[model samples]
Target: MRLPTLRRTRTVEPGIVTGTARLDRRTKRLVGRLRPGDIAIIDHVDLDRVAADSLVAVGVAAVLNAKPSVSGRYPNLGPEVLIEAGIPLLDDLGETVFQAVREGANVRIDGNTVLLDGEPVAHGVRQDAETVAKAMADAREGLSVQLEAFAANTMEYLKQERDLLFDGVGVPEVETRIGGRHCLIVVRGYDYKADLDVLRPYIREYKPVLIGVDGGADALVEAGYTPDMIIGDMDSVTDDVLRCGAEVIVHAYPDGRAPGLARVQQLGLSAVTFPAAATSEDLAMLLADEKGASLLVAVGTHATLVEFLDKGRGGMASTFLTRLKVGGKLVDAKGVSRLYRQNISGSSLLLLVLSAVAAMASAVAVSTVGKAYLGVASEWWDNLVFQIGQLLGRLF
Candidate 1:
C-alpha cells in the first residue's frame, strides 16, 4: 500500500489582473485622475481613438466598459488602440457593474468576470487582438448606414446654423488683432505634436496668430509656444492656461447656456462668449474668418470621414459644414508641413561651402592682387607653423 502512492498533475490557470477600480461615465474626465495600475470603468460606447490613447497614456491596468466598445458603428478605433497597447479590455459588462463596484475598491479580473473580495460582481467578454479585428471587420459593413445618418445630421445642422455660418451673426469680437494676419488654429486631435514640431520654421517666419481650442491650448503650451487666443467650452483646458494672458473666448450653446463661463469667472479670467450650436473647433475657425484673418492654418483638426465619426457626436456634422464654409482660406498643418520641408540639407550646405572656397582660392591664384594677398597669408601661416615646431622641439 505504501508503494502504491502517486502524485496528481494540476493545470495552471491564466493570470488574474487586480487593481483599484476608478469609474466614470465620461472617459475624458476619468483619465485625468487615473493612476498607473488602476482599472478604468467607463461607459463609452464605440470608444474613439482619442479616448483610448488617453487611457493608454495613463497606463491603466485594464479597461472595463459598461457598453460595447465596438457596436458595429462604422469601425470605431478606440478598442483596437487599447488592445494594440497591450491593455486588457473587458467589454459590455452592463450598467449594473457601476452599482455593484464602488470607486477606489480593490477588484480582480479572472478570465471574463470582475471580482470584489473574491466574489464575482460583474462579467463581460474579454477582448483580444483577434476579437477586435473581427469586430472592426463587421463594423465596416455598417459604414453606409452611418454615412446616411451623418448626411441627415449635416442637413439639420445647416438648417439650425445658417445665420451663423453664412453671415457670422453671433461671433464675438476679441482683443487680439487678427486682421490680415495668418491664423493658426489648433485642436488636440491626431498627430498634433509631430505636426506642431515640423511647423516651427513656419511659425517663426509667418508668426501666425496662435489660437488653441479647449485641450489644444494645453498642447500649444506644451510645445513651447504661447497662444494668442484660447477658445472652447472650457471643459478640458486647465486653469493655468486660462491665466496664460491669452484672450479667452467661451463657446456657448444656442440657447445662451454657457456652462463653462462659471469656471472661467471663478478663475477671475474675462472671456467673451460666442453662442452658437457648433463645436469649439468650428467656432474658432468662424471667429478667425469673421475677424478677417488672411490665411487660416488648422492643426490636429478632424479632416477625414472616419475621424469625424470617431468624434462620437452629432456636432461633428458642424465640422464638415464648417470646412466647406472656410475651404477657401483654410489649410491643414500636416499638408503644409509636408510641402514645406527644409530646402537645404547639411551635406548640400557643406558642398556649397567647399565650392565657394574653391572658387575664391582659384581666383586668388589667378589674379595679380589676389596672388600678392595669398603670398602674405602663406608667409604668415609658415611663420606660425615654424613657431609651433620650435615650441614642440624645445618641449620634447
Candidate 2:
C-alpha cells in the first residue's frame, strides 16, 4: 500500500526516529528535553485505542504507529491528537510491520514520505476514511498490541520523571457494613468516561459517597454529579477540583511523604496523606473499607498483567496484592455501563415530585390565604392537609 510521508510542520529530530519503539519508554522519558528534529517511533494504535494524550501534548515528529488506533469498540483518538499537534504519523506494513521492524528500525521522514530501511511506508495519506476504517479493522490485534506497548513504554518514560502507582496500605481483608458507602471512581484513560456517564443515574439513586481520583472528579462533574472526595497524584487533574471542597487524599509511597500531597498543601487545602504502592484506585477502595463504608464501587479499575504493566511499576503487584487486601469489599466497575441495567431515574423523579407538591401547595395557599404555603402550622388544618397529600401521593 502507498503510505503517506511526514511533513515536518513541527520540529523533530529526523534520523534518530527508531521505528521499533512500540513502547515509548526512552522517547517520552526525554519528552520536554528533546532537541528539535527528534523522530519518535510509537507502537500500535487503532481508532478505539489512541491513548497517550500526554505524548501528543509534547512535540514528537514522524510516528510509525505499530497498531490500529481504532479497533473493535475502542476509538482511535490518538492520531487526531497527533494531527492537531502537526506530528507526522505513518501506518506499519502488516506482519512485516512487526517482523522486519525490530527494535531500532532507522526511520527517515521528509515532507510526506516515510522511508524505513529504504522502503517507503506512508506519505500524504489523504483518502476516503471508510477505506481507512477497513484497514484499521484488518489490523486489529496488531494495532492493539502496538498501542498497549506504547502505553507500557510510557510508564517507563514516566518513571524517569517520577513514580506514580503504589503498593497500597497493608490490610489482609476488610469487612464493613458501612451502608451508603462513599464510592470513589478512578480513571487514567478516556474510555472509562463513557462508562461513568452510564452509571451516573444508579450512583445518584444509591447516593453513594462520590470520590474521584484526580481527573475522575472532572469526569463526574462532566457527567453532572458533584464529587465528595478527590484522590490521586494530581498530575492530570485540574486545579479547580483540586481546590474543591471534597476531601483530598494524597497518595504517598510506603514512606509517608507524597509530591501530589505537597502540591495540594501548597494550595492550603487539607490533605490526608496515605502511604501505599497500588494505584490511587487501591487507596479509594482501602479508604472506603477502612472508613467503615458499607460498599465500595470502583469504576475504571485496572485488571490483568498488561494493564497493570502498561501503567508502569513492578506490575500491579501492589494492586494485585491489595486486591487480596480488599477484594471482597470492592466491585470492579470496568464494564458497569454495559452490564448494569439502570431503571427509574432517582434524582429526576425526586425533583418531579417536589415540583408537583410545590405547585399543589402554591395553589392551595393562593386560593385560601394568598400565600405560597398553606400555613397550617401547629393546627388541625396543616396536619390534615399534609396527611391527605401524603396518603394520595402514596396511593396513586
Estimate the TM-score of every prediction: 0.87, 0.49
lDDT of each: 0.89, 0.57
Tens-place lDDT digits, model 2, residues 11-110: 3465223332333423333332332344554454342222445455444445555444433333334555565665556554334344544444456655
Name the regions of candidate 1 deviating beyond 4 angstroms.
1-15, 335-381, 384-396
Q: Which pairs of residues clash in candidate 1, taking residues 3 or more apart in a chain or in different chains?
A: none
Best by TM-score: 1
Any idea what lDDT model 1 has? 0.89
1-396 in candidate 1: lDDT tens per residue?
011112121112464788889999998788777887788999999999988888887778889999999999889899989999888899999987999999999888888999999999899999999999999999999999989999999999999999999999988878999999999999888777778988898899999999999989988999999999999999888889889999999989999999999999999989889998888999999999999999999999999999989889988999999999999999988555566656798999999999999999899899999989989999999999999999999999
